[model samples]
Target chain A: MRIGELAERAGTTTRTLRYYESRGLLPARRAENGYRTYDEGDLRLIQQIRTLQDFGFDLEETRPFVDCLRAGHPAGDSCPASLAVYRRKLGELDALIGQLQSVRTEVGAQLARAELEASAELPGGPEPRCELGPTAPQSPVGPNWEDER
Target chain B: MRIGELAERAGTTTRTLRYYESRGLLPARRAENGYRTYDEGDLRLIQQIRTLQDFGFDLEETRPFVDCLRAGHPAGDSCPASLAVYRRKLGELDALIGQLQSVRTEVGAQLARAELEASAELPGGPEPRCELGPTAPQSPVGPNWEDER
Candidate 1:
């Protein structure tokens, strides 16, 4: 298959395929007419690359899986290298999710505090003399962000 | 204060401050000696920008807050414009958190499935059950990712 046909079959763009080729992750054979040609092996390698790419794997990280497939493994992740990539990816995802969860909490707290302060300035506002104290923290970012204040 | 002094006060880098200035987000006045000078109001604006930046807000998103502070408001987020930005940011954060949670679930499921399959292939693995059938989904990514396969 040609680049266009391969891209169409793989549900990806030619630009992406070209990028993969440039990264040497997916090399193409040159035909008699000076055009790129691909075999069933290339298609399988592409499938391996696309699968891990969708799983949030970097191009470099997908190399192990592609290599495993080219090595005639039953599945892209059938090799130890591929399994190690999966383990590393799991750790990265866990850390990222934790960080994002913390950011969400902090942002939510800041929003609540700002909204409260805004409402307190309106006429006939509720009595809030006890909650807001002189020595209390002013910024809605909370005390943990000592560098910000 | 000079750019370096302002960056030191804001707990940021002079390079970052200059980048902000380049983006026209934090403009500085030129002294008689062709040096950049900033006052207390500028310091407040930088602090506001840095606080929001630490909260994962983009430099452009911090504009309204900086404008509010430049207009002599008590805080960057004390104005209606800044409030609107806050509301929009909250929505974005909520959507992002939801997406991350979904990805986490998907990745956890993948990890568990891979681990189970790996253990199941070990020597003297669990009883040979009839449950391993063709109808079982192969990957946790679901059947929708058939394009990759």
Candidate 2:
């Protein structure tokens, strides 16, 4: 199929398809007229790429797996290098999850603080509080030290 | 203190401080020689800006909150609009976390599958399990079900 057709079928833009091609994830044959021709394998590879990207693997990191697949290696028995790549990706994902969890905790605490301050009447009057503005003191230096070792 | 001093104390580059000034996040007074002068409050504001950025808030989104603080309004109070912004940001973070979690699960599954296949050592020589090459099997219809879905 043509580049446009492949892009339409793949649910991505032609630009993205070209980018994947440039990244060595997708290979296409150039026609006499210079049009790029892609086949079913290209489609499957694109699907795998999209699925992995949805699952958070950056394009650069997904290349080895794509290459292994293209080389006719079985899914689970592909290149040992691919296995190493997967391990590295797993580690990165773990780190990302830890960071996100920390951020979630901080945001939750901030939300609770906002709600608490919102419930109290401001000193001036019944006007809605502007706790997010300048006058509010910085969050207490640290959470209560009771849990500290 | 001057911009250089503030930048040094804040652990940021002078270029970044200048960028913040250009972006209206930091306000500074111009001296006779065109040098920028910063006060203690400005330092505090810079610190707060850094903190907010660390918390994943973009400079544009932090602008109103910074402005309220600069104007001496109560900082912690919930401005409905700012709260709305916070909610939007939280939603984005949640979506990101969900995506990362999904990716983690998929990667884990792939790793398990790879390990299992590696251990099995099937009697038959390896054949390409999935059509990942250009000439691989073509779907009768358009793209694969995963892509269409």
Candidate 3:
């Protein structure tokens, strides 16, 4: 198949396929007419690259799996090198999740504090509140009764 | 102070300060000598921008807080606009963290499955295993008794 057909079948752009070729990832064979040609095996390779990219893998990080596929492994992760990349990516994801969680907590706390301060500065100070204990049922008029009136 | 001094105090490069100026986020005053000048207020604005950036805010997202500071608010988040930005950012962070967590779980599961498959393909098949229940006391030789020999 031609480069265009392979890219279409793989659900990617020809530019991306050319980029993979430039990276020496998916080298295409030259046909007698001097056009780039690809086989179904190359299509499988592209699919593998796309999957890892969707998982936030860097283009470079996909190299090991691509190499594994090219080496005729049953699957990309069938190679030790590919498995090692998976382990490394897992560690990276854990670190990123930890950092984001910390940031989320800090941002949440800051927003709460700022909101409290803003409410306190209102004409009547902080608004009145109710814990809504089990015995104290909600008002029959509903929570937005004032709006309805 | 000159642009260089402002950049140094803000712990940022002059190029970045210029970039912010281009974005109209930080406009500097023109000194009598035709050099770009900044004052303590500009320093505060730069600090506010830096803080939001460290919290993973995009350059555009920092605009609201910068505007609040420029409007003479006590803090960057004192204004309603800044508060709105905070709320939106909280939502965004929550979404991003959730996605990362899902990806983490998927990658972890993939790694475990791959590891199991790899081990099963070894000459002796999968390694023998022990759950190490509480009832089974630890061997004095430690977990690596074979290695100890």
Candidate 4:
């Protein structure tokens, strides 16, 4: 099969396939006509690379799996190097989640404090007041206004 | 104060100050010597921007806080617009944390399944065996090897 057919079958772009070839992750066979040709094995390798990329793995991190497949392994993760990448990715994800959770907590606290301050600056301190009063200060901002922007 | 003094007090670079001025976040006055001058209020605004940046907020996201300070608010978060930004940041952080956590779980499962498969493919299936045999296959990879790279 040609490069375009392999790319179409793998649901990826020809540019990506060329990039993989440049990176030596996918080595294509040169036909007598000097055109790049790939077989079903190349399709499986591209599919494995696409799956790992979707999981946020860097292109370099997918190399071990590609090497494993090229070495005739039934699956990309069949090699020790590929398993090592999986473990490292798990650690990175945990650290990132922890940092984001901390930021979320701090932002939530800041929002609550600001709302309290705004309420205190009002005339009645967020207490129930007569809505019919013409002189009442109407705040155009609301907690639900976050979605508007 | 001059631009240098303001940047020093704000603990940021003069280039950053100029960038902020370009963005209209910090408007500077021109002295008779044809040099840029800033006041204490500019320092306060720059401080607010830096603090939010430390919290992982984008330069554009700090605009509301800067506007709030320039509007004579006691603190950056005292304004409705700043609070809106905070609320939006919280939502974004939550979504990112959730995604990272999901990736963490998936990667953890993949690592476990791959390790189990590797052990099964080994001669003893991860069971304790005599270490005296020279013919026994040794795995060069370990879970702790993630730190070396």
Best by lDDT: 3
Q: In candidate 2, what are the lDDT values of residues A6-119, reduced to their tens digit?
A: 999999999999878765568779999999999988888888788777766688767667777777764422656566767888899889888877887887777668667766
What ranking emerges by lDDT with the best candidate at the front?
A: 3, 4, 1, 2
Q: Which ten residues in a row have the lowest lDDT in candidate 1 chain B?
A: B129-138
Error of 2 at A117 (Å): 3.7
Where does candidate 4 chain A have its weakest 10-residue lDDT segment? Answer: A129-138
After TM-score superposition, what is the CA distance of residue B18 in candidate 1 from its true location, in Å? 1.9
Which candidate wins on TM-score? 3
Q: Estimate, for each residue in A1-149, the C-alpha lDDT of model 3 and write its tens digit.
A: 99999989999999999888777688778999999999989999999999899899988888778767776767878777778788889889889989888888988888998788777776584644322222332346533213212
lDDT of each: 0.72, 0.72, 0.79, 0.78
| Rank list by DockQ | 4, 2, 3, 1
TM-score between candidate 2 and the true structure? 0.76
Model 2, B18-57: lDDT tens digits are: 8887776776788999889989888777886887789788
Pairs clashing within candidate 1: none
- Candidate 3 has a TM-score of 0.81
What range of 10 consecutive residues in model 3 chain B has the weakest lDDT sum? Answer: B129-138
- Candidate 4's C-alpha runs over 4 A off are A125-149, B125-149
lDDT, residue A100, model 3? 85
lDDT value for model 4: 0.78
